[model samples]
Target: MNGNVEVVVVGGGYGGVTAANRLARRDGVSVTLVNPRPEFVSRIRLHQLVTGSDDAVEGFGEVLGGDVRLVVDTATRIDAAGRRVSLAGGGTLSYDYLVYAVGSGAADPGVPGVPGAAEFAHWVSDFEGAGRLRSALDTASASASVTVVGSGPTGLETAAELAEAGREVTLVCGRVLGPSLHARVRRPVARRLAELGVTVLEGAGARVTEVTRDAVQLDDGRSLPSAVTVWTAGFRVPDLAARSGLRTDADGRLLTDTTPTSVDDERIVAAGDAAVMPDHPFRMSCQAAVQLGPAAADTIRRRIAGKTPAPVRMFFAGQSLSLGRNEGVTQFSYPNDKVNALSISGRTGAGVKEIACRFTLNKLVSGARKASSRGSHGDSGNRLETPQPEHPTTPHGTRRSA
Candidate 1:
């Protein structure tokens, strides 16, 4: 171990991995990544995993850069003042800088009367949850009625997949599909859902009051008899930032400026869903994750090299939606959230989405390979040499959103 290592990254998701890999390319900085899991879950494809369309889960070894050291442990607490991180076991990791890339998770709707919801409701956000949902679907009868709550992308994707599988699907959305999308874009989505045999229920403020074994009751006195209910309403950040006394947003997301550094501590940085970048408070998506990861790494590099960091830029070429197999909708949008005139749907849109997914995977793989090559060249000049204690102590009570 060479000591003088400059940065430590928490989490091993899209953003964390990308940032760590980029930082590793710098000659004078060592990057250490801490994550609970050994593999990276392709969260974007989780819907396909749940629908039994795809079973391959990509591993981190295939994507992590060599120069970045992978620590297989959960970050239990962040000691900002001391520039140290306490792991789950009993040791401590000290660093000159830290990046919080812990992601977000589905927000539990505090609806009353929903029985066994926490235990029964299926979500497509993570790998384990997707596996559970897939198993339930396979066991369900052909005539079973599956109710999907939330009209966002995840909900729409889930409904489309089930419908395509020849199952009865009811999409219960408080609003229409792509509520953020323009009316023109929304019309095509509705038509596609209808064509897929998915019953779209809109304006039905179906505030789930309770989730029973066989039905979901809405605030409007209607009971939707469903064999399964999937929730995809909203997301919440991890509570680690708030518990560590760092400034955060109302929903517990770490508050950062355009540079993506923690509001309270310049030594700490954040990205992905866990960060609330004031200048770009866009919705949490893989798109934002991909951009912010590299941006965060660049900022850390600039700071370490005593250079001024550049402002973060927000851009949106378009938004794409997948509707099972080779059918989807792609809507172009401006930087200011304006819906542009270009819209593509059906097979062409699906093709575009497929290309996008492949592009992301390719970038990740390429970055990891570069990182690994750098590590094998006997390069620890930028790497920290401090030997982390074997039995690391995990900080208690840090809540994670996702």
Candidate 2:
């Protein structure tokens, strides 16, 4: 602990980026963020990417710290024993503290035909998948039926986006539409989707039994004609942590206690959708990722200063589900994330959703730039602005704002 603390953050998503910037605020802590992509992806807008409403990318400067090292590379393996991370491209980097935040991806439901049908289905999980989905929509015939499997927020938003654009869309809900919402609030969501011209298929026959290129077969022997099938069911995390010999949960997320430190190794910590906080077990969402990121950084910072870290507590306002540009739904929830049943819909809901998305970006950028004000102007709080000219570079390029 005498020398500089070498902290390597894996994954450049919201959690990792937030941690890197916050950690860079303190001196004697070397922060390096390794990610597969050079640009920061706005995951909240990835669905917009599919609908051609957003590009969902920015130069690292907009979201990463001025003093943090940015390594554009994929982590192949983690050697926890030696504190070394092997890169897919080659070579390895050592760290005194490792922050695991690789995030999650589209899950395979182990259906009979899911794996083979994946090639024909569209996904909104990542940047590459979103781009592919956009291209698919372009080539799909104007009157072709677009079936969106699942009724989660992403599925709902995508179906609404396509329907609003005049595309024939169907939302195949395995159970019920907006299952997370209370029965009272879910009624309005159904009415809104119906108003938007989305076919909400629920009940016993709605569960997907098979996926084909041109249609999705349900358990009730009904086959919905789908020119472009989109699967947005469940998600699974990367297996890097499990393969690295770290103690992880069933889904490969690192198992951590209140401190967010790996049960097997005190030097390793985790955050984001990929993390399963044993104490709180928060759901995988950007809301949790933002907080978890800084918490992980604060833990490392505190541990280096010979102090114990505090457990993470997250706050929730509501769930924002965009029906389209003009219609949406916002379900109020307590700080514990329990639905309070208070709701908003139509344009007002859409406005709230838009503000949340924009505010999320502002918070990320502001958090990253907070390190620049360290000690110089007596500024210590997390406040963000566009990057300044004096911001230092790491290796080559990977910085930008706006």
* C-alpha TM-scores of all predictions: 0.90, 0.92
Clashes of each: 29, 4
Give the C-alpha lDDT of model 1.
Answer: 0.78
TM-score, candidate 2, is 0.92
Q: For model 1, where is the 10-residue window of minimal lDDT?
A: 393-402
For candidate 1, write residues 193-249 as lDDT tens digits. 999999887775656767777788777988898998888888876788888888888
Where is model 2 more than 4 Å wrong at Cα? Answer: 109-115, 375-402
Which ten contiguous residues of candidate 2 have the minimum total lDDT? 380-389
Clashing pairs in 2: 61-399, 61-400, 62-400, 366-384
In angstroms, give how far residue 385 of model 1 lies from its true place. 15
Best by TM-score: 2
